[model samples]
Target: MAGVESAFPTKRLSVPTADPQPSFLVFGAPRIEEAEIAEVEACLRSGWLGTGPRVAQFEQDFARWRGVTPSRVAAVNSCTAALHVSMVAANLEPESEVITTPLTFCATVNAILHAGLTPVLADVDPHTQNIDPAAIEAAITPRTRAILPVHFAGRPCDMDRIMAIANKHGLVVVEDCAHAIESEFRGRPVGTFGDFGCFSFYVTKNVVTGEGGMILGRHEESIARARILALHGMSKDAWHRFSDQGYRHYQVVECGFKYNMMDLQAAIGIHQLARVEANWQRRRQLWERYDQDLAGLPLQLPPPPEPDTRHGYHLYTVMIDETRCGIGRDGFLEAMNTARIGTGVHYLSVPEHPYYQQRFGWRPDQWPHAVRLGRQTVSLPLSPAMSHADLARVIEAVHGLIPA
Candidate 1:
């Protein structure tokens, strides 16, 4: 199908003595409201602003949103922290290995190392940019204890296949669900699929508590342990000690990290959580518009996935077809910027980074497909706030950038 040329308003947006290139069009800015402000003020004025009612309520809201019970979720300060908690929950040995993709954010690999497990690299599917289930199975060794799969760019990974593999090998599954808060796979929410799901609420994510995360688990004991792990191993969170229990008796069973979410961050979530569906719809609309408009472009767009799998559109990434466009990925990024659009690369391969290379001596040949994509995939602006004009601006920018 031929893609539409542009979705810009017929009337050009008035620009008064503009500087270079549309004032650096942003990617995923938050859409906060007065309700958020009021919540923060209430939290402040209430005299108990730590991990109080707001954080507790946010955890409940998050659980309800994902169609899971409260025992399934525990709030934390960052997804990285949540991942660390998941690793601890798995009880992986110091030399045990966790297989994951090379094309994800470094945090995914870093969490493995932080948990005292070896981070094993695996190749990704050329199309999905997700860790191939076959490759994950092949990477398993006697020391392999867990399989960590990233739901890349809010698109659901192939969970059924991955779960089957993990089940067969008796390996724990830890999901890196940073970009996929509202995503579903085969009618089931992504966070509810695995033994542990770690979600990020960083500034760029679908949901924004500014910087926070939630670790979801099925068992009560696991979630409780995660809560303890997140709260410095304290038996009493502020919620239970003061607000709920009205008592000070606390216990500390295990050593843990200080990773609890603050009341201030929870304030933003109380408001944003209500609008999650609306925001997701907005992103879906923008994705469709981009898909319709960029149909025949030289780039290789993400193809439709199987039925019942909803894309959160956390990132509308595309790969540069050097063979077709005559321009490689880096050159394409430069060209796009020149045409007045904002773009970003989701990652350079985790192995390609200096720290990993120097420490592990990881060569590009370790994960060839990931190496190829590390040089190709560029994330286009895909935010709920992005309007039709914004989509048009992106389309116009890409058209001008690509060499005909």
Candidate 2:
């Protein structure tokens, strides 16, 4: 497929003389409703606000949504926690290397370090901003035990190629689906393709939990292990120990982290999951609007979903052409802020971060595509909560900044 920059010709848009938007448009706001609020209030009143019935129900609901068995999912506090637990479940040896894309959140790499594993950076595909399978193949080494592919901006990664490479190398696959709750590739969900699929339900995610995540997998034993590891390695969960069966003593089977999700967050998630499809549809409409409105400017819009796939439309990111636009990505961001519109940088590649550069001795030149993307990419406001007026304001602000 052609890269995003060459996918469309830049069209010239007329500049507007109107004053900037009067109010600040916050990016990625959760579409909270009375149902969410009432559920949370009920959870608080029940006083079983910890990981109880609500969390369990949320996990089951999530599993059902993903077409997976309930036992294959483990709910946690954050995607980072889910990733860490996944690493443990995979049983990666200390110092084992995991090949992953540089175009991802720090947490994606941090989880590897936390698991006592080395993270080997692979560059991303220019078009999708997702880890390229060829880059992953080249990064593989004798010590490489896994491949962590991130579904960038809710677009499914090329999982078929990734699975083939993993199978050839006998490597585990842990999918980072933080932006892909509703994403599917070739009729299957993104998370189910890997040994472990880590999902985020952060406030900005397609599904809002305020703060939560879930791990999905096919291995019953791995999922069981993750459940134990997510809650301080207890053999029996709180609910199991204090349920109708009276106080049953629990055992500390192994060293684990406190990463369990609470009912308060899960209360929001329960309703959020129920409305996820509806919310995704709304986001798709907004994404289409942005694509239509922002065309012809000196910017490269996000590529369309791959064939036979469903996009979650979690984020609508664009790449600015500094030379053509007369402003760099940072400059564009500042202009948007001045115009009372909120914007975000999905990420600067992992190698660009000082810690990774110094610790791993990585250079930006090592990953040309990721470096270019890191320099130019910008995430525009995209959410089901955004109104048509909000969309218009964003379009007007962006067009006003770039010359026709």
Distance (Å) between predicted and true CA of 228, model 1? 0.4
lDDT of each: 0.87, 0.92
Best by lDDT: 2
Clashes of each: 0, 1
Residues 1-404 of candidate 1: C-alpha lDDT, one tens digit per residue: 34454554567787688555465667787777798889889888988778888898999998888888988899999999999998898777887999999999999999888888899988999888889999998999999999999999888999999999989999989999999988899999887778899999998889899999999996778888899999889988887887655688888888999999999899888888899999999988888888888887888887776588988789888888788877888998887777666788987889889999999899988899998888888999888877788888888888776744
TM-score of 1: 0.92
Instruction: Put down candidate 2 lDDT per residue, 1-404, tens digits, no spaces.
Output: 65987777899688878865488888899999999999999988988888889999998998888888999999999999999999998998999999999999999999999999999998999998999999998888899999999999999999999999999999999999999989999999999999999999998999989899999987999999999999999998888888777998999998999999999999999999999889999999999999898887878889889899998898898988888888899988988988888899988988999999999899999999999998898999999999999998888888888866
Q: For residue 29, what is the lDDT in candidate 2?
A: 91
Model 2 misplaced regions, further than 4 Å: 1-21
